[model samples]
Target: MMANPNYASLKELARAKRAQYGVTTEALNLIVVRKIYSDEGIRIDNWEFPRTIRAAYMSDDADPSVAINKTLPREPRLFSLVHELKHHYVDRPKIEQGQIKCGDYNENQTIEIGAEVFAAEFIYPETEFLERLQLLNIEPGQCSPEDVVRLKRECRACVSYQFLRKRLVRLGFAMPHAFDKIQFQKLEEQLYGPPIYKQKWFQRRRGRAQAK
Candidate 1:
């Protein structure tokens, strides 16, 4: 029987894969998931998957593919893509033999957790995250919701606040579920106004009104 990989091993594997794919920290900040998929020859289809199913991967030797939930926002979609990539790399054989399954993570807890670890590390490595926090002078137990917003704004990684919060908790930087009830999007908007697209749309509307 194969030994189940622990978190540290999974993280190392993820980092190695990142290196193999030439994924640098700068690339991660720019969100290279789709580029990585193209490089790996994995086809992507955005479908309206069930809410419970964020994404699914099929390791078909002839044509490997990943189907992601179209309704997921940008950050989640990127994360899910990387999550499926993990399965593509490590769980392909088990998946092919029907020894593992997707969607329902509970059935394959260890593998699923490993995939999560891989995705997280691949997207935003812990060392970089810690470095960013330290640069910002954020200490353990000192991160506030506002600080989290700042982190997201400054970090440049395409990840949700939930992802950041969970990472903080996992690294003992913050208490678990400490920011669960905070509506991060709402807070972000309140702090920085609307997102760039919305600002652009509003500017366009004003320009049209002035011309009229």
Candidate 2:
């Protein structure tokens, strides 16, 4: 069994999907129509799970069904939908036999991690997303956290602020540590609405750094 997923290959898989579907953005319709699962006749539906389990795709006795937690916000729900679809790419046999459980989907396990990467890149194709950012006047090495916020709202793209930040770093739009103390605090507040512990920690850190 492979210990880690081939990220490059998975990226190529996403690229291939883009080329095949003639879509510049994520082809969610493929998953909806069961085409992305290839010839498999998996059905998509909404089944509310516990808060932790956002989605599940089961292939039991050759009966495949994908259930999504509809309570999730738009971005997370979309990501989880893709994450479950990625299981078909990661382990076909296990998925076919109902041996795989994507419960701990957020964990660092190889399959889970691969699914996360697949979902993110699938939703925001790197080149097209970069072009979208560029159209917003946000260029590589020139974008700020504020620019990302504006883009998120303008594009109406479903992605977390953290994901947006990482995407910016990946695309060379910002340095790894580009958002400083104040900026990071502002971003956190904007996304999550004033985290208690993080607020105190950032305050102390900002004070000490400013004193320096």
Candidate 3:
């Protein structure tokens, strides 16, 4: 019999969902994240924070349902949930024995970046995100807030549009050299800046060096 799947393999999960279930990559994304997170004792929500939260809880098993804070923007929430998902990505029940403290800053910084990558790839499939955006007649130039609202709604992305746009760039679908062509140089004026990743490249590289 095949072994039960773990969160360790995003590539595998994506492939399986495609070959086995015939699900779209996006839907496979949701399935993989939900499966990995649920096993790790993290609660996946439908409408709560929309992103996620991962504080150091004092238990072997986490609470079944995490609070859904609707007030926060979806970008932060997605980042948060993605963060928690990474905790499991490392080691689930074994790590949860409190052998490793859950949600420590050092640990969080280590794990969250990968989760962000996973989430970004999942939410913004390189081929799909670019095509979808093209269909909307939208480029990343700072559209009016009204346009932002309309574009996001059209994409069914109620979360942060700019945030997703930046994620697209990181995933290599966005044309960074053509940020001006996308008209973002002018539009990015509204938001303070690009979407932030959890751990920086420098820190990640430093850690990898140490590990090696």
Candidate 4:
């Protein structure tokens, strides 16, 4: 009768969706949330949403149509939708049950991050994205917001930071966290610069590396 607060519930929801729709989790994200929640008949209570940006919300009951806060960017919008779905199954009414306390969550809560990561990786496998980026000669150290956006546009990647971070992690690439990531900046700067020409350099070095 109560909703599950743990983000794991979302993962189960995601896994089930991927299996049913034949789409990767990332690709299935807010889109899936939008579809399933709507089919269930849940609608967002608009008055509860913030003013600046249209925040995504879900109605707890079977009235499944998702009320997307239109102003939120596509990435966060999708994440919020999933977060709201989590609320539908886990958060609401529990305040009375003492499962989750009121005002316990801020806009920047970490569980939202987890849900987004769940959605992103399912869409773009870290290994697959990195290998493809490398194959495109786009190094991780050489990535930026623009590069991220470009990659998402070109590869249809889910637009979330940790998703990109995971890909770089798998590729043994490090991102500068304290300040702006220079790698991405470099890529942005070089966008119109003379191209990088790597003529079979790896091919010549591959045999020795592979043999060792």
| Best TM-score among the predictions, by candidate number | 1
The window of 10 residues in a row where model 2 has the poorest summed lDDT is 24-33
Model 3 C-alpha lDDT per residue in residues 1-212, reported as the tens digit of each score: 34323433653443443354343543443445456556556665444323444332223444534333555554555545544444454445545565556435356543445455555444444456567667866565433344443445466532355565565454444455434345543354444443233337767887899999
Model 4 lDDT tens row, 1-212: 34345555566665565566576534655666557656656764443346544444333343333455566666666656655655554445653354544334445466455545455544554556766687666764665456564664466655556446555654545465612443643454466443233336666677678899
Candidate with top lDDT is 1
- If ranked by TM-score, best first, what sequence of candidates would result? 1, 2, 4, 3
Instruction: Encode model 2's per-residue lDDT on 27-78: one tens digit a residue.
Output: 3543442465545566778777788778877777766778888787766776
- Report each candidate's C-alpha RMSD, comma-separated, in the order given: 3.5, 11.2, 15.5, 13.3
How high is the lDDT of residue 171 in model 3?
Answer: 45
Output the TM-score of candidate 2.
0.65
Model 3 stretches astray by more than 4 angstroms = 1-75, 97-99, 105-108, 137-150, 168-212
- TM-score result, candidate 3: 0.46
Model 1: per-residue Cα lDDT over 121-182, one tens digit each: 98889999999999988899889898999999998777899899999887778888889899
- For candidate 4, the per-residue lDDT at 178 reads 19
Candidate 4 stretches with Cα past 4 Å from truth are 1-13, 24-32, 45-68, 89-98, 101-103, 107-110, 122-128, 137-150, 158-172, 178-212
Off by over 4 Å in 1: 1-5, 29-31, 200-203, 206-212
Which window of 10 residues has the lowest lDDT sum in candidate 4? Answer: 56-65
